[model samples]
Target: MRSTVSGYSALSKAHKFSAAGLVTVAGAAALTFALVPQAQAADVQSAGVKTVSLSAQEFGVTQDGELAKAADDAAGQAQVKAKAAVKAEVKAKADAADRERASRSEARKPMKPAAKPAAKPAPAKPAAKAAAAPVKKAYADNLDGWISESLDILRAKGIPASYDGIKRNIMRESTGNPQAINDWDVNAVNGVPSKGLLQIIDPTFKAYHVEGTSWNIYDPVANITASCNYAADKYGSMDNVNSAY
Candidate 1:
């Protein structure tokens, strides 16, 4: 019985060593599985972060392009408006110039005229001349009667009366009519009464006397005698018959 008990004890010791080796192998396999899975997860996370940054850069570039196009459109509209305004101003200036030229042309046109003058005239002329004298009828016929009467009167007065002297006195006194008077006779008021064929005044007859008769201015014979004596004493001759006593 003792031998059997020792042999069973040795078998028990061998079974314990085999169980320790199996446990060490199981622990090593579990550690290896856990470390490998952690490494693979870190690599996947880095790749995701790089992809997000690329998307944000592309969005910024698109927004800048849209703003540039809007600015260019606004500049083009401003240029078109300026060109239209310049054209309108030029057209207005041309119209004003045309109106001024028309006014000047109207102001240039023309007018009319007036009248004339007159003339003058001329002058005038002169006049003419006259004629001579003549004789008488009684002196040609009764000259001898007158001569004889005058000589008788002279002889009575103691004076000489020639035939020529007597004839001249008769012619002067009455043109031989013994009844003559001046056509233009006027009566005397201031000096003396006058009378007869010879128109002898009172003063002249009183101053000279005739022989055998009172002085009578109205008697042709008395007047003739007195005038003959006065003429002989004052003037020497009776030849100028028209102008003598």
Candidate 2:
């Protein structure tokens, strides 16, 4: 009986020691699990922070690209506006030149051609006289007619002259003769004789002949008109002409 009691006591002690060891191991495992979760959370937080930083970098890159694109668009717009302005200026100049050329051409053209008579036998003398009276007379035919025509042109071309003024000069210069010439004057001795109703020298005629009239200095209308131009240049207007000059 003593030997049996001793063996039982030994077995009881061994059981108690084994139970304590199991409790200690369970506590260590629980502590290890909790620490692992905390480490994982820390890793997740670090990764989130890195993701946010990368997102910020991407946003900055996008903003830079947008700014560059906006700058490019602005430059392109400016180029287009500049080109348009240049094109408009060129067109305006071309249009102005065309209008000037047209005006000059109009000035060089004849007013109208003389109409042809009808292809018919001769009519009675009274009827013929009546028909001839109705026919439009040319303004360049006589001195009175030439002066009147020149006054009309001067008004249109912005050249200032008057009927009384032109008539007075014409009567004094050449007695209203379209073919008058100054053969014995100082100008004649100089080989630059003054001719025509206005007594204009060849050099003077070539210099001051009206633009829309005949280029011939002896032409009645051309003579009167050219004289007016010269008179205006020398003395503001033909009305001021009262001397040999």
- Candidate 1: residue pairs that collide: none
Scored against the true structure, residue 78 in model 1 reaches a CA lDDT of 74
TM-score, every prediction: 0.32, 0.43
User: What lDDT does model 2 reach?
Assistant: 0.74
Q: How many backbone clashes does candidate 2 have?
A: 0
lDDT of 2 by residue, 182-227 (tens): 9999999999999998899999888988788899888888888888
User: By TM-score, how accurate is candidate 2?
Assistant: 0.43
Q: Worst ten-residue run, lDDT, model 2?
A: 1-10
Q: Write the per-residue lDDT of candidate 1 for residues 133-192, one digit (tens) a residue.
A: 433223222446545665567667665557775676566666666545444435355445
lDDT of 1: 0.51
Clashing pairs in 2: none
Model 1 vs truth, CA RMSD: 31.9
